[model samples]
Target chain A: MSKTLISARGLRKSYGKRNSKFEALRGVTLNIHEGESVAIIGKSGSGKSTLMHLLALLDKPTRGEITLNGHPTARLRAHKLNTIRNKKFGFVFQSFFMNANDTVLNNVILPLKIAGVGYRERHRRAVSALKTVDLDDKRNNKASDLSGGQKQRVCIARAIVNDPKVIFADEPTGNLDSATGEKIINLLFKLNREKGITLIIVTHDQDLANKCERQINIKDGRIVSDTSADAEQDDDGDEEIREIIAESEEDDDEDATPDKFEGDNNIDGMLDQKHPVHHINIDEDEEDL
Target chain B: MKFLDIIRDANANLLRNKLRSFLTILAIFIGSFSIISTSAIQAGVNNFIDQQVDSYGGEGYLAVVSKDSFDALEGLTGAMGNGNSTPIEYKEDKIQDGMTPITNEQLDKIKKIDGIDGDSLVEQKSLNISYVSSKKTDKKYLIGAEALPPGNIKVETTTSGQLDLQGDEYQIQLEKKYVDVLGYTEENIIGEKIQLVVVDQFKHTQKTFNVKVVGVIAPGVISMGYSYVNNKTADDIYTENTKYYPAEYKDHVVAIAVNYDYKNHSAKEIKDKLEDIGLSAMTIDDIIGSIKTFFDVILTVFKIFGFIALLAAAIGIINTLFMSVQERTREIGLDKALGMSSARVFLSFSIEAISLGFWGSVFGITVSMILGNIANNIFHAEGGFLESFPSFNLATYTIKDIIIVTVLIMFISFLAGTLPARRAASKNPIDALRYE
Candidate 1:
């Protein structure tokens, strides 16, 4: 097996106070090897996003430890974490959160700029990253003026500008149609294959998950099935597990309608519990079927 | 992130909301304009006053009088207006009516003072002139004239020549207004003789003495419209005016002008030594200190108003930045997620505030300078208040004051920015990213 780049043990995350506490992740322990394309699949509120956040070190777990490159990350200072994230990881979100008023080149320069790269060198790297995504010609154009696909391509350029060891993508193509989504997926996979950059994607799309080399399915904060573990079994067993994942997704969709109202209230309560003044709440309800 | 990148992004973000940023800058501009303008005016006034001080016998010059005489003069002026002191009790030993003369004993002691230049002492005598007349005009005008004080004194003049204090010939530095009335231009008046008629009050007789015009004196507050004459002219005129009086009365000296070592000894030290001999001394500052105090009070009030305006501007900075922080929540999240440190996030916002201050103060200094020059020109034009005083500028700009104001305003802006910057820096990345 390839060397493990990241490993987690008994990861748990909970939101709010003791009485109204919601455990997003109960106990998720996993290991991701170098250069692997992995997809974490789950419906809304299944804690797939929370698990991804912990593994990416974007957040700390309530009762767990995460190790990156065999070194414990729990005791690291905020400055070290920021430096690690800046130099080693890149992220892509569904909304392509870019400075809309800025040019595409500046948008792609964000990561390199954060890493404090020299002006000319960062510019050259950003341009080269843009070339990788085949959007070099549109670099000077305003980010807001671009189409959704082009904007996502620019976001991808930003992600790879620092030459990160791992790229964490959260619903990278959720806002794009299938044709545009396929192109984005291909680009991400191409980076994974050619540059040997690890890809960790969090999504509810089964087709997108199936395309990845490994798939981890989460349900109610627990790992239900992992395709890598099933790979040791027969081919028929792998097919059966895939069928089970699809049926469970269908069951979640059926169960979602009634739980939608309660889930929204829970989000509101969670927002109040976390930051009453900011009103920063996750829109988990919108991600459901 | 690099500091330069933070600054660049800060300026870019400000441009994203031009109108809002402009209004905040406008508020700061008002404060800076008022402050810098007042400072310029204060500097101009100080420059003019310093020039006047130089025209008067300069740093070491002192006017010595008997303590009783100085107190009486003060009492008279105090009664006339500005009643700041209580009425003095009538003391038998103090002179109640007129000025007390500096006795020969006091004069001898004054000459003995450590820093006093004994040879520079000249008895102050009022010249009783009947009238001044030039041959070209055939018209005589009443005039007040006094001898130029001892030591190296340069009277500010419209024309070139200086009075020869020790000249054997009667030399006079005529006032500017007298030059035109005497039918001579400032240039043509040089080396020409003018008649100074001194009249005897008892005998009712007049003696006309011809004094050469050396220079035309510039109009100034300290000169008080008095023409300057050499010692020969003043002594002859005084002798003629008091021809019928007793010898003792002729020698009675009310005041004396003297110079001291100002660099080695302060004016107060000399004054204290003179006071020990029952005499009072007034330095140039004591003579003109009231005018300075008046200007200082007015300028201080104006500065206070400027600070109030700056306080309001600081609030405006806080308000503008808070709104900006709220608007750029998602962008800040993306920056933080991209690994921009919390301190850098705070710095970016602080830089935005500083940029606002920079632009505001720069605009303020530029516009105020333009307007100050325009005002100076207007005040110095014909029929304007400052037209008569050509040496006085109504506004002055110094590089030190400009730099100080810019740094001060920028610091206030940074302080005002801290509130919003801290809010931006402390924002949790996940929550901010999820904030739709």
Candidate 2:
């Protein structure tokens, strides 16, 4: 609940030639609050992934205005964008895209490495991030050898290694089993609560979308809907959000209402007893890894 | 950021692809090998040539007649080029009494000529040589090679007993080993009393002096590339005693040293003028040129061999460069995408090619030297080559050839880098990246 951290307006992306131009994203505007847990959900190819990619600075927009923190990314140089991405953004992919040659610790520590942190310090920081995903024991193991779920956990650890302000997950649970998917979802929301880290995910699964505090849906190349999960508890800060995802059942043109992901902050009831945490810190600054 | 780190990392990368690097460097090794080995052999040949030429002083040299020497040798040899060129026999023919009447007047005039630095009219008075060594009884097939004044014989073989003592008509460079002897070895047994027999216009033996053993000479000393060499013809024939017919012989030969003033006129200029005065002038060039047709054949054979080696090395270099480009495809793409110019890539590979050639040359040179030495040791060139026939000095190239070889190698390196450097510059960034 603070000033907007990101605001996108008139974003667009297209592929192919003029006559057969396949538009990935059309003009869309949205605002995201500080430390907000937001998920954009729709059926596959509804411009959800393109939205995430644009927000993540992985690719430039064909035509758009996207402001992160406060600066416009309309024409930032590749090196400058890489610097911002390294210092402020993190990503987790459905395929668990970790470099096979690197150890679990090294994969987690890459962002900080790109940020030019010292070797000893990066190692120490990466170890701590590994602990976050309960994968400290597998620190020296090569990322390539990890199981599917374990690989996802390693990716989660890497996303948080540099203490990034924004963590983006593009179909984070698409490859995991049902039980593993629930665990990962629980972990994402836990970080949003305890550490006040911003979270954004692009998913086609409606069940996964219902778990987030807010959902922004896209149809064709345009935003079709944006709303909370709880229709009546939009005012009270303690609004309960149980998973209400209807992902694969949605149509391209269906209007999506935002899903409420927050629960009562004082009880910690919704979370498993296994989860552990401390005071929340939502500072705009980042800690060096 | 760190220079040493960059080289270390590059070196490690090179080590990772050991086979590729070795194959690449092998081209250089072969190229340098060809250049170096050939040069070493050339050096050996030149060294041998120098030993032969060293005995003749410098370049090619000769002394001959255009007309006649005496009735026996009249026109038995080739002429000195022109129809009326000076005959060298006249210089000796014109000399009578104790003075060269025509030469004293032209001594300064000869000096004023364009390429004539100095000249000597030599007289060799053959004395019956005696060995004082008690082990000898009328033995030794050697003569004290004696001559007079600035007049000297070209003693190609230093082992010969060419006496170096002071004597009128006897300035000899005796082989150091045969100094003082009062008798003869069995080889020279006409008589034991080694003395000079002086005679007048009448047929008579003016046996004046019983010469002490001031000198003796070894027989085998002439095997060092000599035009006029002898090994004790006959002790009695040249003794200070008898002759088949009576005559007062005052004949001499001319030995001229040509001035190295190559920029000015030639010695042939004065040689032409010498004929009018009944004199002759011959140069080392004429002597060396007489056998030039033979040398041309040798040069043609060596050139073909050297060309083959050089061509093979070039092909090796081209192969290495192409492979290197293939291996670094992704790296090249990354560099290009990151703003590296193709020219820089070309330059880098060019340097590599040049270095490869250089190291190859070095190795080749070394191997050649070893080969040369082995060959020399195995087939010792008996001193007969120069001593027997027309032998040329082979050391120290004409300076022109030295410059030629240097320019040749540099040009070869440039040629070797040709295709490789171009291929490196021809890579496309997008295509190369997609090569994975």
Worst 10 residues of 2 chain A by lDDT: A280-289
Prediction 2 TM-score vs. true? 0.50
For each candidate, the alpha-carbon lDDT, in order, equals 0.84, 0.55
Deviation in Å, model 1, residue B153 alpha carbon:
3.2
Chain B TM per candidate, please?
0.95, 0.59
Q: Please estimate how well model 2 matches the true structure, expressed as its whole-model Cα lDDT.
A: 0.55
Candidate 2 residue lDDT tens string, B365-424: 556556655555444456634332223323223344434544465467657777877876
Q: Which stretches of candidate 1 lie over 4 Å from their true place?
A: A229-289, B55-57, B84-97, B246-248
Interface C-alpha RMSD after superposing true interface residues, each candidate, one decimal: 2.8, 9.9
Fnat of candidates, each listed: 0.70, 0.00
DockQ computed for model 1 against the true two-chain complex using alpha carbons? 0.41
What lDDT does candidate 1 reach at residue A88?
91
lDDT of 1 by residue, B371-397 (tens): 999999999999989999988888898
